[model samples]
Target: MAAPSHGLTAPLSGKLKNVNFRIGFVELGKKKKRVFVKCCSSGFNGSGICIEKCENWKFDSRKINHSYRVKVQASSSTMPFASPKSRFVSKQEQFFPRCTPRNSGPQSHDAPPKRDTGIANEKEWGIDMSNENINESGTNEDGSTWYRKSGEDIGENGYRCRWTKMGGQSHDGASEWKEMWWEKSDWTGYKELGVEKSGRNAEGDSWLETWQEVIHQDEWSNLARIERSAQKQAKSGTENAGWYENWSEKYDAKGWTEKGAHKYGRLNEQSWWEKWGEQYDGRGSVLKWTDKWAESELGTKWGDKWEERFFGGIGSRQGETWHASPSSERWSRTWGEEHFGNGKVHKYGKSTTGESWDMVVDEKTYYEAEPHYGWADVVGDSSQLFSIQPRELPPGVYPNIDFGSSMPPDDEPPPNR
Candidate 1:
């Protein structure tokens, strides 16, 4: 039996019967070693030898009229054979041949097909700009590219850091890309900004999206503003093919001081839809408003407009909310609740969904209090915020993070540090 170089140990003693043996050479790694004593046990009529369960050693077989018991010994050392009838084959063959190539003839059709990239010989093209403050810029073997950089500076009061990365891929005439940039400064008046963008383009279809945020904190006030927008279009390769959509939003530190608008359509078919909405939270009051309309590709249409506001706490508030659909379905609600200085309350509405009767509320229901929104809801603590420090991997060393691209080109091993 043929065993792995590492698995071959002291001589292996086994039994065989009615067998004829020959010596052959099997290629192992970069060298060929002689194979002796080929036989199978337990009646497996294969051309290969087997000791116990091993069946990878190959040899020629012939019918012998006389049956006789024979001992087989496999070892790491070679054995010499001097029998006049003994035959030795020197052809270097694989110990365990798993496949035979089908296209081994001289004719082109019989030859293996060549791997085809779009270009006949698309040589790699890229540039390296790695330095103290920046690192990693190049193209990958699969025609994808990426750039990344990071830096930090310690100031008198605190520190500031920034990071940016952009990557893209091209394949089968389609392209996809993304980028992110972020900065944070905790020195004196704290400030931070971040932006992200991504998009993809394929034959007759494309989409793009972006998000940005800015935050400022000082002794007097803490403020933040975040915005997001996206657009998508497909002209010729999808059901209801001519499609389009765009939306933008703005959010502030105030709990509900957020506003946004969205629009979509099958523009080529003249069908369109839009929505606008806003929210407010402050001065012991909260309000929400929305107005939207839509015309579908099938000529169906609908519209909805509503607003709800609450002030003076719990049961003492006023607002109205209503909606109407193309099916003539209607819903409406209105409220006008007031709280008296003596703890008494009065409530009224034109068409209310819940009970309109007023009752004596809790003593602090109408107390003066300002709503506070914490930055932790959107950002993080110092430890979490500064956890992503700049890294300097040696050239040819790739980090485990996803680069939105294929594997980078192979490079020579970096010198030992």
Candidate 2:
């Protein structure tokens, strides 16, 4: 039939520019089946290879399609020659397979609708539609809208929506919306279309609600004054009360005086000198003076007879006796005598009282008199020999004086007599 469709019999070969032209076949119900060759490629227009040059050729029935059907089968050894046919087309004539079908089955109701991916379309996707008044009616370059509600003219530059009063009232009057920019014009008036404005005031008013009216200057000033007055009154009440007094009293109480003679006397006195008056003989007394009369009087007041006592007008005690010198006498002396060689007049001088006045010498003249023979000088020297050159005496002259042996030897004569 139709020459058994010789198209299946030829083993296509050439440069094999497209693998779609290559194909293969297998016979049914036979072990030793025949081989058929047709457009030997995997897809239309030779998209892939059907048989590789180095691989063992095997008939694969699964790849067979209606367009490349098998008729007569040929053995692998039969290298059939192909004749020219008009089926081949140029490379540009090929068409790619379509990926998506025009119509899919009914879409599930749960599937979300596709949304526009562009940034401009995002506002339509459930964005907040509530109007917002930024300053006054103004449009950004991108067509975004802004508006304002209260206050003065929207500042300058890009500052759009602001407020102003009908009259030139300074921060205190009815307010109307005003638009502002670097340059002013009559087109500044516009409508405020938005939700309530939100922000905080300088005085800490939060923006939870819209401001119905501008804050009055007098109200603000009065509130400031009330706050300042409250603060000042609180400060003065605490500071001017008895707080400092109690503090000072407690602090000063550390030196509080107790009731006693010593305490009262100390308080009444101005200094240590005044505390004891002139009673104390210690150096701390104020009445102390270098004048001789005052010191003498002071000594007398203390039961001292110093004026008639020591040569320097000071008194002293010896044992139980209080010895004193007369006021006119600077020094006083006692007299005594001793005799040797049977108390004969030749041996010692006899006093008018006959009490053996060998010699009566006081401490001052003992050395000048040069008395001898049992005459005991006050300072114990029988050789009461005063000398103008006193330093030339022998070493023992002062220590070894014969106070007991009070007579010259009969064999000795008076010195230089």
Candidate 3:
């Protein structure tokens, strides 16, 4: 026996020997090294068979001192090397040269396939043994990994499946392309239960009904009744007194003084002055004798008082006297006769035929007349007098008066001015 050469071994029968071999410490360079061996046969004329070989045989520090060994046995020459039995096994054992054994173990007949040991069990490794058979749960199109309820099929994409649950819950788990579960036949029952507990349907019907009832009972009825009453009062023309009374109440609450009532009497005086001043042309000078003389002649009546205040004592001494009759015709009056020398006056004169005695005076003369007139009469006359005044006054009186500066050539003056 060749002392069982290392890791290489052979079976014998005077034919090529069947042997197991492993490479060990076959040094190639100072740093680069490898080890390789395989099952082979030794025969005449350098005949050797290689089988079950290691891939990329190399040597490292851990395996550099390791060795390969072989074994063989001599046998009769009647068995040829080409025989199938001789190729596989022999009757005797023999050893090969240049090999040694590192440890004692039964010689392996086959080598494991070359593969990455870490990922050997992965699905991508082309090994069907590692594939998982997952049963999806739920009835949805997405093939997710879960035990599906009965009557369900794994969806084509494996993300979902179609299934039915016990309690009539139809699991159509595709909510926005995602899987979900819900009760099918119990939807109406669920709604009714919700209505019984929360007093509403899923569509919010009872809530809307409650809101509508509130609006009808509280807002709509009250507001409609108030609006109807307001409309009736408006049509009947009875709102004026009520409106004024309410306005008066509001004004009183806000601390607004009554028309002629003021603690200092200043508001009354100011209002009276405003009433009189508004009618007078401030540019014309006052005359001393007119207001007093007119008051005497006119018997201190309300009309005469307003006239006195209006013209600031109208008279001839101030300047010219322009009088406008009720007919709106302008006439230059005898200054002394029509207006007192002070610029205020109440002139009573009949027409040229003395048929009717009518009063004529300037706007200033009217202001002096208001104090003696009844409040109603004064208000009425004031309105009428204001109506007669030229709608467009000189800018000296009202800065904002439009004087047709920007009007087109063909445009007529505004009507009824």
Candidate 4:
């Protein structure tokens, strides 16, 4: 449970107990330290892994004496399908880890940004960004966790970690080898549920002081929501309009700080997914809102915002709030969501290419993309011109729409944000 030495708290901690069953996601929300979550299981083989509970405590700057308060989201069946008699529950669909960062923050800037410009920044917490093949691995001598510090760049290393455990006494549990940018690699040994004593032991190694075995779950239970600090009220309670110039991963001009759900079939009789976030621009006039749902049957809303970094990148500090490049780029890309002041509500933003988008809040329309098609554009909605859904945008969309050439460079792929 050693945390990163910055403002960010540990977003997640998962150890790959079974290779076929990886922890899907663990993340901190947009409203600073107030909101966070850690989901488990890859759903690869119908295996059920979950974070039945959540609790947190703060260590003094000196890193001593953390007071933890664990809340069980569901007492029974919280970590279901790990029972000794558990059977393989398979479906045609596969559930990936639910740990994708959305860049939906506050919106600012009286004018839109130049979306045509390009940038890139990858969120692979613990892998070599430069040399995907060259990785630096480390194990928690005392615990069940292991880490791979990226050798690709100067400041890339273990920022976040995820874990999972096998269930049932019929077997000695399971172990696995992990290897995903945000995923754990290689299982060393087997363990049950509940990982206690996450703190480092003498000689400096985190130990899983204790683990709880899975109690068979006959019926699904609701994942109890862990209460947290107060959140900032911005953009109808959204973080902010999260899009910025280039919104790309390659141009991480500012060292910034930092998922989805599924497989939780009808926890309490509903199977649906919801995600919402916001972002702002430099002038504090632009804004973006996103309200997306997966199954669409349930009417509950999910909350999160776009981020500069992530769970491990949480505490990263910003040296410059705004930095403009020689090209058409705005340094405000790393600013916080509340940095903008546009008081508009725009929903259903489509990631034109999974990064930039077109928005309309309070009759003002905004668009962001690379220079190829005019980065930022703004116009009063007096004509009700932007009333169409993003899907309805004209085929050429914004005109001169580049179909993208021979695939973007390896480093410049469209972002999940």
Candidate 5:
């Protein structure tokens, strides 16, 4: 561990300097630079504001992570700032290093020139593999736009390739777009591995929103897993709001599935969060839970939670539910039944005013129809969107290649989880 070192100190002499904040990091074997907004403007003299930011970083040489903190002093004259003099790694970089692009600049259709290429596993497989590349971008007749870039290696046994594509439309000062990427390898009668990513964005007057989902699969059991995230932010006439959420799912052919999701956001003086998930056994059994909580600027708070199990696919139900109100009222219930019968329930309620009640009674419950569980699907296909085989490339259409070494470094960190 190293002591926190100060990176910048503003002089107290009243002279304002345009903020020129720059930081560098070597991520994925490439150096990246970040430039912050120019600060110390006179426009904010009468406005009261404060800002604080903290970033976590991991050095390759150190076993533990480090925290880089920045604080802006809130005052009338100036906003003095303090920050740790160290590099940091983003949550995205920590988790999805390979899935995220190394460069943060606007993605162009141009591919980096090939630096050097060599065949791997040539002796073991006795196959000579050659590199193929492609890069194309153009506007379609429908007024939509599209771009594609890819590279691959083909051998006698199998092939490995990576590609990215983006297409969308813009009109009337509003736009919607989608981008997709894939990296995969397959060997005949052997193993396979791959990752795929899809992202979409929508923007309009005073609002912007985006989401990205990635899927991974391997040959071990042909099991597939999916990860997804989304964020939306908007502002209207002196009020602003933002929300973000992340979720993941894993499943296999053997009838086993698991999923989890969580989300948190803020609106004006209130902030809230909700998370839920369910698991289904191929044999007709399911387990699920939901938790939600919220708070207000005035110190009011409330929350709800539910946990349930359905035996033989809703043939029976057992679960507990809890709710809390901002007025200090609390209510809870629990029930268990086999096939909607032979069940008992316990109920309780309490309030800060010293009122409370509890009771027990016989209970019977059944779903009139199939339950929707908790979370709605972000992308269809039950969360298993990929197969074991890699997508085939077009024939004899290989061109521009960047060879990975020439791509610029990513300026922005991966999105926070």
Candidate 6:
């Protein structure tokens, strides 16, 4: 019944670039370099966005197993999809050319990697794998301030640490300073959230991820990703056992922004393909960002995409920050997005930080400014000491005012500050 060509002629080699073709098939990707065409083994059903390649038809020749016929060979990096309802068959390969499962039952090219029910799959992949015990510091107030705790429920959810010492040294010597840890794991109705706590400062700048939110309705919390290795079967030569996420981000308030891709190589012969690294937020800040990589089969040069933009607070705090530096020649894979505007982009999740706000402790106010005398007279009762503190200097500059309120009674003179 071969109908609907609409081009009257010339479909990909040259002319015939638009219109209704009686209505049917046109989705493509990549034009100048070849290989576009969304659904065309002779079927034809396209959409668009494939600026190179593709002149008339090329995406390995087509036919991705409607039920049988599994041809797909740009060399066979792989693209296997079979399902008796799918116990698990969505296994794609990489480097091009390896997918070959014409329905054989139990499903196995080599088999082995797929185990569940282990520490509940290591807390369903949030992975702490359980096992933590840290205890040493004891004394409180009288012993120069100290504390220590372990796991299984310390400061409420688990893990607690507090340390403070002066003259004798403990701030950097390590007496155990400000530390916290939390845990959670529940199943039935489901609840498996994760928390990461980090605070370091013995040297320069220190502070790391204290939050993580997965946009909710949580499909096990997006499986919480971050899987590095261990899970490779096809006999372990490495195929379904590694970490490879290409363009992975499913934005959904229900609007579903859309992001899902997978292109492997080696069964036949393409090479690399990546597109993971996206941190975009709108009203809450973190404007837009992307970290990309390419080299499936086009020319030879690996691709790159490091974008950054922040008109306002990207998630707030210190504001804006999204970097993805990785072009020393692909440098393994590629990653981008740094801090923008600076507020800190929720720091890691949730958002907000003026120390946590809500502190209305009026009346203890004390100001101290000596050198440039740049004005520090909010006063709250140091017994009215102002030798020559008439105020009026802004040269060298030194500012450290702590006004918990209460000390402004120098009799009508606390206005300039």
Q: For model 1, how does the per-residue alpha-carbon lDDT over 51-75 read when each residue is reduced to its tens digit?
A: 1323334333232463223333433
Candidate 3 lDDT? 0.23
Error of 2 at 267 (Å): 99
Off by over 4 Å in 5: 1-133, 136-148, 153-159, 167-178, 188-239, 310-360, 367-417
Candidates sorted by lDDT, best first: 5, 1, 6, 4, 3, 2
Model 1 error, position 166 (Å): 2.2
TM-score of each model, in listed order: 0.38, 0.10, 0.12, 0.20, 0.40, 0.21
Off by over 4 Å in 2: 1-16, 20-32, 36-87, 91-417
TM-score between model 1 and native? 0.38
lDDT for predicted candidate 1 compared with the true structure? 0.39
State the lDDT of candidate 4 residue by residue for 297-327, as single tens digits.
Answer: 2343332334331121121111112223435
**Deviation in angstroms for 295 in model 6?**
4.2
Clashes of each: 0, 28, 70, 82, 8, 80
Query: Please, what is the whole-model Cα lDDT of each candidate in the order they appear?
Result: 0.39, 0.21, 0.23, 0.23, 0.40, 0.26
**Candidate 1: where is the Cα deviation over 4 Å?**
1-132, 135-139, 145-161, 171-173, 184-190, 201-204, 218-283, 297-300, 313-376, 379-417
Rank candidates by TM-score, best first.
5, 1, 6, 4, 3, 2
Expressed as tens digits, the lDDT of each residue in 40-117 for candidate 5 is 321111011212222322223211244233233234123323322212221111221111122221221111111111
TM accuracy, model 2: 0.10
Comparison by TM-score, 2 against 6, better one: 6
- Give the distance in Å from residue 116's predicted Cα in candidate 1 to where it truly belongs: 42
The residue pairs found clashing in candidate 5 are 57-89, 102-410, 103-410, 104-410, 112-401, 112-402, 133-399, 284-313
lDDT of 4 at 370: 23
User: Best candidate per TM-score, number?
Assistant: 5
Question: What is candidate 3's lDDT per residue for 65-167, written digit by digit as tens?
Answer: 5432332222323222435654544221111111123221112111111111111111111111101232333322222112212332322211122222211
